[model samples]
Target: MSDDSNAAGAVEHREVVVIGGGQAGLSMSWHLTARGIDHVVLERDTLAHEWRDSRWDNFTLVTPNWQCVLPGYPYSGTDPDGFMSRAEVYDWVRAYADMFGPPVREHVEVVSVTQSHGGGFDLETTAGPLRADQVVVAVGGYHVPTIPRFAEKLPHGIEQLHSAEYRNADALPDGGVLVVGTGQSGAQIAEDLHLEGRAVHLATGDAPRVARFYRGRDCVAWLQDMGHYDIPIQQQPGGLGKRENTNHYVTGRGGGRDIDLRRFATEGMSLYGRMVDIVDGTAVFEPTLTRSLDAADAVAESIKDSIDVHIARLGIDAPVEARYRPVWRPEREITELDLRAADIATVIWSVGFRTDYRWLRVGVFDGAGHPCHHRGVTDIAGLYFLGLPWLHTWGSGRFAAIARDAEHLGERIAAGAREKAAA
Candidate 1:
C-alpha cells in the first residue's frame, strides 16, 4: 500500500505478493482481488511465457479445452472437447489476464524472499526491493531442465538439447534423432518426428500410457465422470508419492489419439530400454525394453479396466469395445547403440525438469527442498505455495483446479489479515 525510498533504493510494499505470472499466479491474483486484498503479481518474464516459449511449436494441451478454466474466465470456445495449440493456449491465458486486469508486474523477477525483522516478508527483486505482509509462491515446480551428466561424454559433433529447446523435426540436423525418455513430451516429440519421416531411436522409460478414447467418449471425459480428477493426493494409491509419478503419455494432436510405443516400434522406430550411460561414443541401455513396454501397456489396460467398471456400475448404455492387445513387441534385447553407426545427428533429452528454489531463503521446505504445506498454507503463518502438482488434489497444479486452490488460499490470506488487524 506504500512505495517508500530506502538506502538501497525504492521499496514498494503490498499486503500480498504473488510470485509467477502463469495461470496459477494469475488465478491467485483473481481470488485475492475478489477478496479485496491488495497484491502485486511479479513475473520474471512476459505473461504465459511457458506456453509461448518453452513448449514445442506443435505442442497441444494434453487435456481438453473445457478444463482450461480460470477463476472467472472459462473456455468460451465452441470446441470444448478440442485441445488448444501452443499459440492458442498462450492467447487464452493473455485474454484471461486482460479480462480481470490483475495487478501483475511482468518482467520483474524475485531474487530472494525472506522473513523481515519487522514481522513481514522482504523480497529482493530484479526491478527493486519490495515487502509484503504475506507471500504466495505460485511458481510451478518445474524450472531447470534435467539432463544426465553423461551428456558431456557424448561426441561434440552430436547436437544435444533438452526437450524444451526442441522446436520441430526440421529444426534438428539431418539423419536420425535419438530421443531419450518416454514421458509425455518425449512420446509426443517422437511421434512428431516420426510423422515427418525422421528416423527416431527412442530410449524408453517406465512412463505409463493411457488410451485417448475408450468406449463412446474420450478417456478424460470418462475419468471426469468417475470423479478421478477430484481425488485428493492424500487419498491416492501412492499418497503424496504420486506427485513424482510420470504422467501417462498420450497426445491431443490430430484430435487426440493413443500413443502406443509398440505401434511405433512396428513402424520401424527403434525402441530401447532406459539409457544408462554414454561411453566412448556409444550409448549404453538397460536390457529391459520388453519389460518397460509391457509395463506401459499394462498401465494403459488398467485404465481401460477402471473405465469398464465405472460404466458397468452406472448402468450406462456405453458401447462395448474390445480390449487393447499388443500389436508388436521387441524381437531381442538391443542393449547398446552406437551413435555413429546409428547415424544419430541429434540427441533430444526429454527426461523432465527439476524444481529450483535456491532463491527462497526460508526454512519451510523439507530436506529434499520441497515446500512443506497443507494445501497451500505452510507452517509459517504468512508464507504459502501454490500451483504445485498434487498440492491438494490431482487437479491442483492444472488449469482445471487452480481456481479452487487459489480461492482457498485467498480466504486463508484474508482471514489472516483480519486477525492481524484485530490484534
Candidate 2:
C-alpha cells in the first residue's frame, strides 16, 4: 500500500464505491464489511433520508414487520402484526449503519458517474470528483413521481399531486378528492381521505392482480420463507417472474394492516373510469368498460373480506367493511367529463414508478432505462446493481429479498478486486 501523499502524487481512488445509502446500499456495505473489504459508501443524503423525508406521514410499510428485516438485522419491535411506519423503518436503517459503522459519506450528491478508461469510474459529485475501481448503483426505483401530461392543463382549482407528495387527507382541496390510479399507493391515499370525511372519487385503471395472502401465510412471509429473495435474478422461475413483471396490483403491504380500500367503498366512495384529460376541474372518464362494474365490485368485496378476516384473526384494528362508490364501468370505457366539473378538489396520481439511470454514463442500461444485469452483475466490470425489481428474479428486490443479491454482489466485487490486484 502507498501513503496518502504518495497516493495523491499518483491519483485519487477508492477500492469500491457504493452509491445510494438506502437499504440496498447499506446491505451491500454490511456484507462487504463482513468480508473485511475496504470500501466507501457515497450517499445523496443522510442514510435512509428517503424513507424519513420522502414518505408520507401516514405512510406505513405495506409489508409486515417480520418481512422488513435486512441481512444483518431482524425487525426487533414488539408489533409483529403491526405494519412498520416509515419513520420506524428509517430509524432501523440508521441503526443498522451505526452498529456496523459503514464508511458512509453523507450529503455527497452524485451528479454523474461516468466510466473512465481502464475499468474505473470518475464520480462527479457535489463535493468533487473522486475515482473508484468499482461502483454499485443503488438508487431506488421510485425516486421520481410521474404525472400524466394531460394533468398540466387542468384548472387551478383541481389540485394535482403524485402519491409521493400526499401526506394525509388534509393535503386535498375542500371538496371531493379524486384519486387516479388503482395501485397500492393510490388506493391507500383515497381510503385515508374518505375516512377523514372527504367526498372521495377513485379513477379506475387496469386493476393489478392481487392476493390476500400467500400460501396460507402473509404474502410477504411466504415469499421470504420460500426463498423468493434467494432466487438469483438470472435463475428466477416462471411464476414469480410473471408476478414481478405484472404489477401484482396491490401494494407490498401484507395482511393485519389498516389500508382497507373496501371499507371506504362501503362509505359512499365515488368511482370513475379511465381518465383521458382534466379540462376544468373534471377528469374525463372512458365509457367502454361500464358493463363490468358490478363484477368488479364483487371481486373487490371478496378481496376486502379476505383482508378483514386475516386482520381479525390477528387481532389488528382495521375497519373491514365500508362500502365504497364505484364511478365507472369495470370492463372498459370511452370517456366521462367528470374531472372538468368543479366538484373534485385534489387529484392524487398513484401510478407506478419508473427507474432512472441517466446519471450512470456507462452503456450498461437497456433502452427501457433499466440496468443490464444478469443477477446483479453488470456488463461494465467493477460495476453492479442491487435491489432492483426483477434484477435477478421475481422476488429479487423485495424488502426481505435484497439481502441475497447484496451478499452475492459483494462477493463478486471482492473476488474481482482480488483478481485485478493479482493481475
Candidate 3:
C-alpha cells in the first residue's frame, strides 16, 4: 500500500495499474480484483469521465439498455428496450464503481506512461508518480477530436465546437449552425438544432444507419438474436471488416430516430456532402451528396430486408415497416455554403476522433498512432489495452463486450503472473 500523491515528489508502486476509469478500466478492475491482483485504477477525472462531461446534454446510449452488462452488475431494469439518458448512465457507472469498490484514484491525470529503468511501467501523473508491474491502457478511442486544416481558413465570425464540446442548441449564438460529419454526434446535434427550429446544415458522408425497431422488435434485439454483434471482425460482411472502424449513423433519441439526411432535407434542413474546403469565406463541399444519401438508404433498406427474410424463414409473424424512399432534397450537388449569406454562425465538427498515444512512451503504437495490440494483449509483457473498437468482434466496444474482453485479458495477466513466479 502507498499514500496518495501530493504536490511534492511521491511514488507509489502497485502490481498492476489500469489507466482510464471508463467502462474498460472498471471492467479490468473487476476481473483483477476477482483474480486477487494488487492493482489500482488511475482515472483522469470522475468515473467514466467522457460520459460525465464529454457527451451532450441530450445524449443517450446508442446501444439498448439490455446490452449494458457490467461484470457482476448487469442491468436488471424492466425496460430493457428503453435508452438511458446521459445523466442516468453517469449515475449508473458511479454506482457500479461503488458496488465492487475498485481502488480508483480520481482526478489523477497521467501525464506520461513509460517503461521504468528498474522494471515494469512508470506513470507520471498530476499528483506525482506511480510505478506498476503491469499496465493496462483502458482509455477509449475518442481521446482527441479530429478537425480539418481548412477550419483555420474559415472567417473569424464562425464559431467552432468539436462534437466533444457541443452540449445543446442553446449554447450556440442565434444564427444558423453548420454540422460537419453527420455521424452519431453530428446527426444528434443537428437533430437538436432542427427540433429547436434553428436553421441547420448537415455535412454528410457515406454514413450508414440501422432501423431502431425492426419486425415488431427493437433493432438491437433483432441483431442480438441474429448474432450480428457476435460476428468476428474478419467475418464482417460487405467489406465492413476491411475498414478499421465505421462511424455508423445510430441515434438513441426520437424513439430510435431514423437519422436520414433526406428526412432532414425535407424538414427544412440543408443536406450537403463532405466539406471539401473552405476557400475565401465560402465552405466548399464534395459533389457526392446523392451518393452519400444512397449509401445511407442502402444500409437502412438492407437491414430491413435481412430481418424480413429471417422472420419469414423462421415462421415468426413480425410486423414489417414500410420502406422509406428518398424525400424532397436539392437535385443538384450543394457543394458550397456561403457562411455569411447563409447566416451560419457556428460550425460543429462532428467528423470523428483520433487516438492520442503521445504520452505513452511505448513502441506498441501503429503508424496511425493507435495501440498495436491483438484483442487487448500487446507484444510487450504486462501491457494490455481495452475499450478499443472491434478489438475482437463488432461488439468489442459495447458494454457486454468490454466485460468479456476484460475477463480474457485479466486471465492472461494472471497466467503471466504465475509464469513469472515459476521463473
Query: What is the per-residue lDDT of model 1 for residues 98-203, given as tens digits with 9 covering 90 to 100?
Result: 9989999999999999999987799999988888999999889899999999999998799999999999988899999999999999999999999999999999
What is the alpha-carbon lDDT for the whole of candidate 2?
0.70
- The better-scoring model by lDDT among 1 and 2 is 1
Per-model TM against the reference: 0.98, 0.83, 0.94
Q: Give the TM-score comparing model 2 with the true structure, all chains together.
A: 0.83
- Go through the candidates in order and give each one's C-alpha lDDT: 0.91, 0.70, 0.83
Worst 10 residues of 3 by lDDT: 1-10
Per-prediction CA RMSD (Å): 1.5, 5.5, 2.6
Off by over 4 Å in 3: 1-11, 117-119, 237-243
Tell me the TM-score of model 1: 0.98
CA deviation > 4 Å runs, candidate 2: 1-11, 209-217, 222-263, 288-334, 340-342
lDDT tens digits by residue: candidate 3, 212-293 = 7766787778878888877766677644344355557777885565676677788799888889899888999989888877
Residue 67 in model 2: shift from native, Å?
1.4
**Per-residue lDDT of candidate 2, residues 1-423 (tens digit):** 114415544555777889989999999999988887777888987888888777777677766777676787888889875677777788888898888898999999888988887778988888777788888888866767878889887776668788888887776658877788776677767766766888888776655434445334555554454455566545544632443353434443333433334445556786667676866544677752343244445654565455556666667664334454544323334366555453876778887677677788889876676667777788788899887777766555567667877988988988988998899
Weakest 10 consecutive residues, lDDT, candidate 1?
Answer: 1-10
In model 3, state the lDDT of residue 313: 82
